[model samples]
Target: MKIHIIGGGNLGSAIAVGLAKNAKGNNITVTRRNIGFIQHLTEYGIVVSQSNTEGISEADLIILAVKPHQVDAVMAEILPHITNKIIASVLSGITLEYLNKKVDGTNTVLRLMPNIAAQFGASATCISARTADLPKANVVTELFNKIGTAVIIDEKLMDAGTVLGACGTAFALRYIRASMQAGIEIGFDAKTALAIAAQTALGATEMLLNQQVHPEQLIDKVTTPQGCTIAGLNEMEHQGFSSSLIKGIKVSLQNIKSE
Candidate 1:
């Protein structure tokens, strides 16, 4: 499979790396106005990082990974060479209709929102393709499945998905930092506290997958009535962890909508 990717930024590079590592005979070209990511794409082919001005070769898919503001310009740049191929866009705020208007012979349009875990092939991505593009949607699903979990969502809901999974990394990290701080305050060294806290978080996440237990149920197991864990839980609850997280996600979602 051959893919031409525009905007070789973090998310773009991440998806490319994921595909190149897992797929056989995969040819990927990360194209953008600049070559900031050219050095990284060299192992695959030097041609991709070069200017895509001459037009890209026939590709199974063409990806637009440029910033939201650059969407129009990038689409215009690729307009002449554009083919009737699948175009998967990972840019935020740019809708399908805008893209359809910008490029011709390109009915196969898809919008994706994937988090940063993609670098480790562990991202959570949501995809939505047009009706004409539905036939080829699974190909994208399968490709992203190599990187992380992929779910099909309505395009209307993609902005929310961005706030949910795309920005969720920092939310998880905040908990990790809190846990590490708690460990340190109790007497563990910085490194030991961080290791234990991070591993514990990892273990808790794995438990959610491996054991299929609800978070509250897991908390139940950890906190015996009148125990130290319960005391900590009570204090955290008093401090409004649930309220804070809910408000944070709500505010973030609103911010995405506003943007």
Candidate 2:
């Protein structure tokens, strides 16, 4: 597949690198516009840092990674050039309707919510199609699966996916910090604390998935009756861990419909 990616920022760069490293038989072409725009990529083979780049046209897939405010300008510049290709975007807050309106084509446009973990092929991705038939969606889904886990969800649920999976990375990091702090209190080194916290989080997620058990059930299994672990867990619950997490998700969801 001939792929062209626009924009070269953090999320974009990560995805680009992820693709670059895995593009065994795939054609990957990234546009950087001009020398002043992405010179860094010149040294790194179409790197996303600042330099001139080829225009859009040779792509079976067009991935847009521009900022929300700048999406219109980019789309307008490339809209007329689009054909029956797939337009995959990671730009937040912009609806699929707005994108299709700006970039006219019989092409299938998809909105994806992916975390930075895409760089490591572990992202929890959510995709929503605009005018794509199952064949195209499946093809696109398979392509992304090379870099992460992909799920085709309802458009209405995409925002919640963004909240819990996309923006939720920051919240997960915060939880890791809290875990590390508690580890420090128990006399562990900072490095060891972080590693243990990270591993524990991974294990917890795996258990939830493999065991197919509710979170409360898992929690009950972990906390023995009248034990120290139970005491600590109870105190944390009393201080509002679950409530706070729910509130954070609600706030993140509100950000989606915000102007």
Candidate 3:
């Protein structure tokens, strides 16, 4: 695959680096006006450029990772070269309908939400395309799977997926930070506390993924009648831990929809 990624911002650069690590033998180019920020991508044999049209002309897949407001200008510059290419957008709230209308419905358009974890080959990318475009979308799904897991979803649920899959990374990190703080208070130094908290969270996630069990089932395994685990869990519940996280997710979705 000849992939051209525009914008070269955090998300774009992450995707480029991730693909470079996992999708060997595929030519990838990432463009940013200020090329210094992404110059390091060359270390992985990725061609870094400051020209969108140059990249788009040579790519089989063109990923638009620019800010939502920049789409019009970008389309004006590269639309002519994009015919029949797979056009994937990582811009939040930019729907396939908008993209289709922009490209005059000639290209295979896909909307994808992938977080920064893509740089580490662990992002959970959610993709959506029109029913007729599913076959092409699957090609994109397979491409992204090289960096992380990718799932096809209904366009209507894209906002919800953004909240849960993209913003959710921060929410999970916040939980880890809080856990680390608590660990510190319980006597471990800051560095040791963070390592333990982060590893514990990773282990718990691995268990859920590996066992394919409900989270409550694992909770049951950890909590005895009056164990410290249960005591802490109950205290957190009493203080609205789960409810707050749910509310935060809901608010994030609401914000995305409002935009």
Alpha-carbon RMSD, each predicted model: 2.1, 2.8, 1.1
Q: Candidates ranked by TM-score, best first?
A: 3, 1, 2
TM-score: the better of candidates 1 and 2? 1
Better of 1 and 2 by lDDT: 1
Model 1 regions lying over 4 Å from their true place: 43-48, 53-55
Query: What's the lDDT for candidate 2?
Result: 0.76
The segments of candidate 2 whose C-alpha lies over 4 angstroms from its true place after superposition are 33-55
Shift in Å, residue 67, candidate 2: 0.2
- Candidate 1 has what TM-score? 0.91
Return the TM-score for each candidate structure: 0.91, 0.87, 0.97
Could you say which candidate leads in lDDT? 3
Ranking by lDDT: 3, 1, 2
**Distance (Å) between predicted and true CA of 221, model 1?**
3.0
Model 3 gets an lDDT of 0.92
Q: Per-residue lDDT tens digits of candidate 3, residues 147-184?
A: 88899999999999999999999999999999999999
